[model samples]
Target chain A: MNRRRHTIPTLALKELRDGIRNRWIAATIILLGTLALVLSFLGSAPSGELKVAALEVSVVSLTSLSMYLIPLIALMLAFDALVGEFENGTMLLLLTYPVRRWQIIAGKFVGHSTIMLLAILIGYGTTMAVLIFTNDGDTSGWQAYLAMMASSLLLGCAFLTVGYLISSLVRERSVATGLAVATWLLLVVFYDLGLLSALMLDEGKYISEGLFTTLMLANPADAYRLFNFTGITEVANLVGASEIKVGLAAPLLSMLLWIVVPFLLAVIRFQKREV
Target chain B: MNSTPTIELKAVSKRYDKLTVVDGIDLQINKGESFVLVGHNGAGKTTIMKLMLGLTQASSGQVLVMGENPANKSFSARRGMLGYLPESVSFYHHMTGLELLNYYASLKGVAKTEVSSCLEQVNLSASAGKRVNTYSKGMRQRLGLAQAILGKPELLFLDEPTTGLDPSLRRDFYQIISDLRAAGATVVISSHSLSEIETQADRIALIRSGKLVACGSLDALSEQAGLPVHTRLAVATGHTGRVAAQLEPHFEIQKITDHSVDLVCPVNKKISLLRQVADLGEVVLDINMNAPRLNEIYLHFMNGEKA
Candidate 1:
């Protein structure tokens, strides 16, 4: 067997193990799991021909909920990365070792990301399991449901990168926590409201389809929403969901771009950080 | 006096805006020599250590450990040579002592097979699996010490190594330091406790307000202070006045009391002076001879010289 022996994976495993042992992580996982279950059961809709089944609807809604929740968890995990060491005074001891600073950052990122991924898998996986068992392997929603699950993992990666960026930039854990919460509110909730208000005030003519596409491309949350509702919504399907006026790529590609840019920027900043 | 200088600072100076933390200190710590740096608060002792370890950048001059800059990103050779104990040894509270050691051991590239024995060395074998948060202050210090010696690092930097330790533990700590020195590990210890470090350090350096005020062996520094080694004489009768008058012209008499007299003179002249003082009068009580300690030398430079 060819094991790559990646530093990130090793660190991620270590972090996951540590998290599993911690009561905070266990409690958070339970809370998120309960939230996933409630969101799934409460949000499901009746099925129709060519429409996603109740289980798939539940899975999709749960995936959207995860888009917001996973990032918060990631930030909570990483905000104190450097600052915690400074408070605890362990950074000096670590810095004296032969390991490079980038490795430390990368390793920690991977570890926390793995934990987030595990949480998502466990939480959403349980929701899916309940849906499948309740419906008795109803086959209608499985494909689309799997796609949503995959997208949620990608979204978790995106949020994990953001958390690392916050950790790297801030010197105090308390400040980082506040900033992370504020950023979550802004990017996940208020950002969409702001975009919607802007579009409404500008009217349909001035905003244009290209401007709407470009705006959606700028924010990960919007891009994720666009991907989640791509051809599913009656209004979007009627407005010609297949057209790509903002270049040749679809909204999914725009979402992928959102994932790549911030991730790369975080890695760049992490590589240059001095312990 | 060893073959190699484990830590070499060439014209190194570290400044924070208008204030200099470490000022142009050119120092070399020889291999296998327990070098002690003694100074008070803001004396730049910690700054020098930070500069050597590349924790802080020097404003000017060069720092080389084993002929390489520790600041360079790719300078693994220099970094691998060092095992450092920070002033306040804080660790990951969530991790057990063994886990923390294993984590550090892996970072230092120490093979897993040797970790158990390394744990044993610090007397942490019994509680190695316990979380560090539960460990006492002395236990944490010992854990920190264990990590420092994990790979048998060729160079070690210990800042206040015995701060929270008990007396017996402190003795054990020095014994380990001495063994490290004997086994060819150069150790640099920075501390405010001159009494404890007096016997441990083969060479001592004094820093005052970011500048190297004095650097040498105890005997050499004592000579540099130029403060006379004190000799106290106690007389039975009223010869205190007469003896003071008799010896006043010949030597610089520091103090003359009713029953006793104290004088500062050369270490070489102590025997002859004692003989002369005894001959002049009936020496009823006792006489004590003492050399100037490092604390007095440090105070002399701190108060008398500009940093």
Candidate 2:
């Protein structure tokens, strides 16, 4: 029992070590940090002399960036996690160990999640520090920034789970990569466009406000956007969330669902997988 | 200490959709036995190993390891005492050898301090700090062996262990296997290198197309094959023809050269052949008797199966 308890952490630490050695963690940190820095600095520039809220504008732009970048990065990190090991023959060696199948999934989840969280923190945290030092935004703007960072992490987790599901479903890493990219395209880029077109074609008759709200919360990226942009008053006013009828809890709960359901499905798939 | 077999397969069969990989086969390997499984390509040697390791479930029948159904989730306890070296051993190329060993040790619930010693045992201590990608094929194989022997597992499964090793390294590898067996560990190795394993294996199992063709010690297999032992008589410079003429009527001459004549005698008839060669004492400069080798027995069985 004690041995099983240690297996997950041990495997997680090994994954982290491999990530560090492969420079994936460093690359993610640098990628996220550079992008966040550019968006924060450029977005705050116009509001400088106009006396507009610099932090609020920066939050909106960063939230938009997170919507596209975080999920992509998370998927890239995790799409190959399970299938790559199988391709490399490590999965056979790993399975021969005393660890359970769920432990493998859980350990990878913990490791990839840690890497994503670190990237988000260092990337956005540096921007937050700079903004706080440069301008005295209201406490509400700071709170919105914090909420955006948290939701970005959650968004990454949700996609990471999706990547694991793709990894477990496929036999080859190349197939997993293709499926992951398609998943990203479907969820982040095309889903909302398709939804908008459907709504436009409906002429406001069939697609009600409540259904729209549910549809928005259905996609994790949209859920993340609503939570970060609409959950905070300062950023919510800027993004015009007055028409969004759903309470704050719906998006949050849906985001949590996005993380849990896919992850559970991944665990189930991994459990029965032959490798 | 108990008399239970370390591994047992009862009518075990494995199939991949329409293709049957392992046919119905029953086997039992007892504690501390040094067993070797020999077969040609696509002979299901690896499938048997996977079945014993519980990496793949059997399509029907049962596979028991350490007296537990290895297919069950609860069989993880048996895995702690099991060590496996896959056919094409691979590792995280980014990790140093020591780091990889340490990770496996942690997974096996062994002490972290044993990592260095394990590396030393495989003669990889000098390269322990180097990343796996920097190591040669033999080094990577050594690292694989190091991981397999880390916890001094009670049951070790090695698939083609000497695949890429040089002759000396292969000798060193079998030396390690011998030492492990001496420590009362059950060692099961599968290899196509028949002559090499012939010396170290206490018992051998020959598989052909997922079926067990023959199983026993070397001498038992030789007896079962009914192969002949060869006798070569080296005569004085001009006596080769004379010796061949003298032996041709009573013995079958397999080959003849300027200086020698070779005769094949069944295992039971070796002594009579030797006595007859002794009668031609002065003409025969020297006489040598050679027993049937493992290669011949293996070929006999493989061809017998084909027939």
For each candidate, report its DockQ versus the true two-chain complex.
0.34, 0.52
Q: Please state what fraction of the native interface contacts candidate 2 reproduces.
A: 0.75
TM per model?
Answer: 0.86, 0.90
Candidate 2 CAPRI level: medium
Error of 2 at B126 (Å): 1.0
Candidate 1: segments with Cα more than 4 A from true spot: A1-10, A48-51, A231-275, B1-4, B231-289
B1-307 per-residue lDDT for model 2 (tens digits): 4688888999999999989989998898989998999999999999999999988999998999988888789987668888899999989888889989988998899888788888888999998999999999999999999999988888999999999999999999989888888899999999999889898788899999898999988888987898888888888888899889887887789999989899987777777877888888898989888888889999999998799
Candidate 1 lDDT: 0.75
lDDT of 2 by residue, A92-146 (tens): 9999998898888889988888988889898888888878777864433777778
